[model samples]
Target: MSWVLGLSGLYHDSAAVLLHDGRVVAAASEERFSRVKHDAGLPVQATRWCLAHAGITMADVTHVTWYEKPLRKFERMLVSQVANFPRSASAFRRGTFNWLTEKLWVKAAIVKELGVAPARVLFSDHHQSHAASAFYASPYAEAAVLTVDGVGEWATTSLYRGGPGGLELLGEVLFPDSIGLVYSAFTAYLGFQVNDGEYKVMGMAAYGEPRFVDEVRKVLRPREDGAFDVDLSYVSYHWSADQSYTRRLEELLGPARFPGSGFDPTTAEGKRYADIAASVQRVTEDALVAIANVLHARTGLDTLCLAGGVALNSVANRALLTRGPFARLFVQPAAGDAGGAMGAALWTWHEVMGNPRTLDTPVLPGPGLGQAWDDATIGALLTDLRVKHEVLAPDTVAVRAAADIVEGRVLGWVQGRFEWGPRALGHRSILADPRRADMKDRINARIKYRELFRPFAPSVCAGAEGRYFDVPPGGEQLAEWMLLVAPVTTDDFPATTHADGTARLHVVHAAANPLYHALLTEVGRLTGHPVVLNTSFNLKGEPIVSSPVQALATFFRSGLDVLYLGAHRVEQTGSYDG
Candidate 1:
């Protein structure tokens, strides 16, 4: 038996993945275990948990692989600092200090932390990890792979061909010219954190027109062949530490939004920010579409595997499917650096081990690939807390939870393994009825405490997705992972529908998450529509709840009416309404 441990960390979204032969035994981000949002430390807890879950330890693993070539990345950083010279003094000093102290000693760190042999530590290229994460796990045996992110070692964008043979490197767009960084620049300009706030920019785009596309084009121009020419003068990510944009970007886009300032779209200032966001999103979607077309032409493949942080743009995914050349799109669920860990493992298995791509590998393991607690564990915790709760029967839990939502009661739901990606899915999700018109505002104000423009998603069973959303052919794959945004054809479910009449619809599959699928069915039976509002079971800036203790604590603190921890239930009033 061959056990391969894959790790990606020390920058952001640190994670660990355990792959045995062709099976993904376990995968998890450190943030979940560490309870630190985007935790960048070594994935010590996550890696240990993975090994424990598989009844093994680091010593039992055949090899340990890192997601990126750290030395190559150091080379990029070193060259970039020298090229930028005095301008990069502070950023270089800080970066070099960290690299010298920690990042450069990755092999030593892995060996010390995991107690692994020195020679067993392997490293894979960053883009290759991103490519393997999507392709090897996709349903298509042969497909085109495209990975675009802010920067990975040196490549910001990469293209590849995947088949039973192996991945083929087609091309790359190096750093200092990245669509991902360009979008992140707008993210910072709009007064949000770079990597964490790009999704907010996507949501903010729906509120305004793409009126500033011309101005945005001046900063990032897309090529006919699906690449972009980014103006480095207008951006500061390459050199600056305090900000992603420079005075030149502010001059080009008008005054930047002040950080932490009140933003009301009814005001002209907020409207301007929205328009800029819309413009950036439009340009980004167009550039990705162009890239998809070029990759499609290059590979002549019907399916495309997309990964990287940029692929998490759900709205752009809808565009790529409807307007691009590919008939199908498969975006990695863990599309960010966290997924690079899983991809590195898969890359080692197939690309390095020379294993044939098997039908089993293409099944696309469900997102419930992390820590899980059984009913007994949850019950024991409730008892230990001296909390009044009911031990629900496994068969009746879904129906009772559906009834709670139907009665306008909000539920903090925790079940099975926490999701493998950033999305909450049905497990570790807060649920409310979408039919309630005020549900979105209520959750945003009282529960999530997030920006008003950030809309909640809807969860519907896979086959029933068409009834609520105008999902196109092959959209099921995207919908299963919350990777695509689709138009809500009707106003039947109002809360899940965003300003642009679209929802990042999550399609629950019976095989993948039977409890969630059943809950949706019961919801449809009670409300005549299966759709329900779903959001991650975390407040604005926290990682999703991983354990029953976290779930119970969050439920009591938040405005949630009830808590469902596995087959157990806890209600605030101590009275069962259903």
Candidate 2:
């Protein structure tokens, strides 16, 4: 059996995945263990965790693969900097220094970090990694693959055809013409962090009309063949690292929103910003739909696999499924740079190593591929911490937790393995009553401490999805990974429903997560609905908790009313009313 270790980081969302005999054993992001939000390091901690989880050492690994080619990325940076020359002097200086000092020698860095041989390390193209992550993990014999993201080497977007053999690159759109960057630029214009706040912009879009759609179109133009281009004069990302948009953008779209400023939807300026966000969201969805349609027409394949940062936009994903020609869609849960690790490993095993595809082994083993602690370990930790807690019977924990939710109490629920992706798929999640209108605000302000407009998602029983959500016929899988948004059938669950009456839904299957499924079933028995508000279990600007220690710390620090760690339960004792 061959073991492949894959790493993606140094840019953003650093992560590691261990593939044993072409099947994933463990995967996790560095940020989760490092306690940093989007840690951009070598992911040493994550690497160690993956190896330990697989009971293997670095020396036992057959190969180590990186998500992208550093030299190629440096070449792209040099070309961009040289083209802009004097205008990019400062940015170029920083980029060159970083690359020369660290980034360019990624293979050596990985070797040094892993203590592995130089020849053991390999590299894959950025978009190819994304494509491989999606297509290889999908349950398809053949499919059309689409990957879109902020500049990777030179390609920002790429299309591929994948089957039992391997993936073939079909076409690509180079940098400075990216839908991801365009959306991120708008995210910055709306006074939010560029890479971190795109989701916030998607949430804010639901509150307003697309009044500035024409203005945004001037910045991003879509063609009949599903290809698109950006007006570079308005974009400053190519030359300037500090600013994504130039003065020309401000002149066309009015003044940009101030970062960290308070936003009230009732105010005119706030409403204007929402309108701009709505315009960007609409244009982005349209462009993605156009691209999907073109890929479907070109490949003549009914199934589509999407990956990269742009694929994280659940709203745009739903639009593609409903409006595009593809009959089925599959999106890897961690469709961002973190997923590139898995892709690189798969690419090395099947494509570069000339190994045949194994149809029987599933590419992805659900999202719980991270660390897990058994009941004995959790109980020992609780005792060590001297925290007030109770051990309940296995069958009663879910019912008790569901009762807390029905009584309008916020809970931190941690069980089994940690999730391998961005979304908290029951393993590490905060649970709350979805029927309360103010539940969203309460959790946002007291627990998450995030923006007011940011929305919460819902996790419902699999078969009961259509009873509350307008999920399309083939959308069940997408919903299972929380990759699609659908309109709410009724306004009963206001907290989970966004302003547009849509919710990013997760359809939970009992076979995949029996405990979470039982909890939802109990919720249904009490409230006549099988859905609950679910979000990541961590404070703002922190990664999701991966251990019982981190879970307890967050529970006490935040306004969570209760915490369920395995079969043990801990309730807040003080008068900390939220």
TM-score of each: 0.98, 0.98
Whole-model lDDT for model 1 versus the true structure? Answer: 0.90
| Residue-by-residue lDDT tens digits, candidate 1, 234-270 | 8888887777888998888889988777668778888
Candidate 2 structure quality by residue, lDDT tens digits, 1-578? 99998899999999999998888899999998998888899989999999898888998998899999988888989888999989999999887898898898787888887787998889999999999999988888899999999989999999999987699888999987999999989899999999899988999999888999999999999887789999989888899889999999999989999999988878999899999999999999999999888888889999999999999999999998898899889999889999999999989988888887777868788889999999999988877777778899999999999999999999999999999889999999999999999999999999889888889999999889889999976677889989899999998899999999999999999988999999999999999999999999988878899999899889989999999999998998742223
TM-score of 1: 0.98
lDDT of 1 at 570: 91
lDDT of 2 at 113: 78
Compute the lDDT of residue 238 as modeled in candidate 2. 90
Error of 1 at 156 (Å): 0.5
How far off is model 2, as Cα RMSD? Answer: 1.8
Clashes of 2: 0
The 10-residue segment with the lowest total lDDT in model 1? 356-365
- C-alpha RMSD for every candidate: 1.8, 1.8
